[model samples]
Target: MTETPSREHRPEPLWAQAAELISEQITRDGLTPGSRLPTERDLCARFGISRVTLRKALGHLLDRGLVTSSHGRGWFVATPSTVREWPNDLESFTTTARRKGLVARSEVLEQLVRPATLDEADALAVPAGTPLLVLERVRFLGDVRMALDHAVLPAALAPGLADVDFTAASLFEELTARGVVLDRSETAIESRIAGEALAAKLHLSAGEPILLLDQTIYDADNRPILLSTVEYSGDRYRLRTTFRPR
Candidate 1:
């Protein structure tokens, strides 16, 4: 007697297939991270899917952390990967993440434009009472917490910097667009015991090891323009740099 065997391989949902193809297209086009993708209507037309199906596909990509949507700016590629090698030359965490093929996302912990105090002014070599933009964020690689970064710069340096969405914006890009020349950066790194407060934010236990990085960025004129501190979670990431002797 011949009995029909039940089908063992099931077809993927149309939306899931669409999502896969869209992700492939992102790589095939060599799209840069943070670059906007085609509009939803255009994507649907290209993929031969309806708007509803397209939305589902996009949602799937969003869930996979491959794309982000701006209020009116359409979808942006979030292509990035892990960070293990550190560039000896100056670099931004955002750039490092992209170069290392890891998605970099940030949770804005603080963003303020306020008058600089005497200490802040002295650190940045700016006049006291000058408007300074303060930014703090918990940087992440995919779902893993990586570092807590704090930065202060003259508010006028980037006119609308305070309004940028730090979660998706890169400070270096903003500074460059504003014609701010980053000539050099002086940096120092040390190991420290994480305090209860920092641990709470970084998901580490009190007294855990953390790498503290202090840096000051200077302009082409050799004037200090920005001061930054980044505390990297020791368990999650290690800092490395190449050394060469002439």
Candidate 2:
């Protein structure tokens, strides 16, 4: 007869196990946003773990953005918001919103034909002091202010653009109607904190998170037609892209 072989069982890491348990507890208890979690001591005892292990578990939750902590206050569930995906495409904000079955509107804050600044001239490949039409508008999704857009275009490319009714039509559509075909765009996005003026315009608290998009639009002949700086409410939007391996 062969001697029986012994088997050893390996357990999951204590902190990971604790994290899962706490996550389940949060769900089971129906904790909503801003709901305070139990004290550290209470969690430690309940999980039958030391303070270090409990803290590790909580750290995991914090890293996942599922919870947040205050200096004197305890941890609380994070507020969740609807995420709007912005794909890598040459699409206008109005078109994107319409596709989502949301109403989009614009409030033109300023529109004028002004001499191009050095940066604008460089981006548009035009000489400094060239007249450019600048359009600044506040965008709204239904009733909520969503973004602010500042677009600069060569006046020679789009004559009478400064007089166009931006509030009543899409900028891209207007340009297309005027025989300017936008073929592609190069864009960069970064996170930013809202300043007092911007926050007031967007109806958000000062220092709120926002997304800044800098784009240079080009025509089929690789001629830069427009440069835009768009600021979006961070909580109300998200950027997503799909990639395929070559």
Top of the candidates by TM-score: 2
lDDT of 1 by residue, 63-86 (tens): 676775644457877533235446
Clashes of each: 6, 0
Q: Give TM per candidate.
A: 0.65, 0.67
Model 1 Cα displacement at 150 (Å)? Answer: 0.3
Residues 168-230, candidate 2: write the lDDT tens digits: 578987898889999999999999999989987876667878999999999999999899999
State in Å the error of residue 123, model 2: 0.9
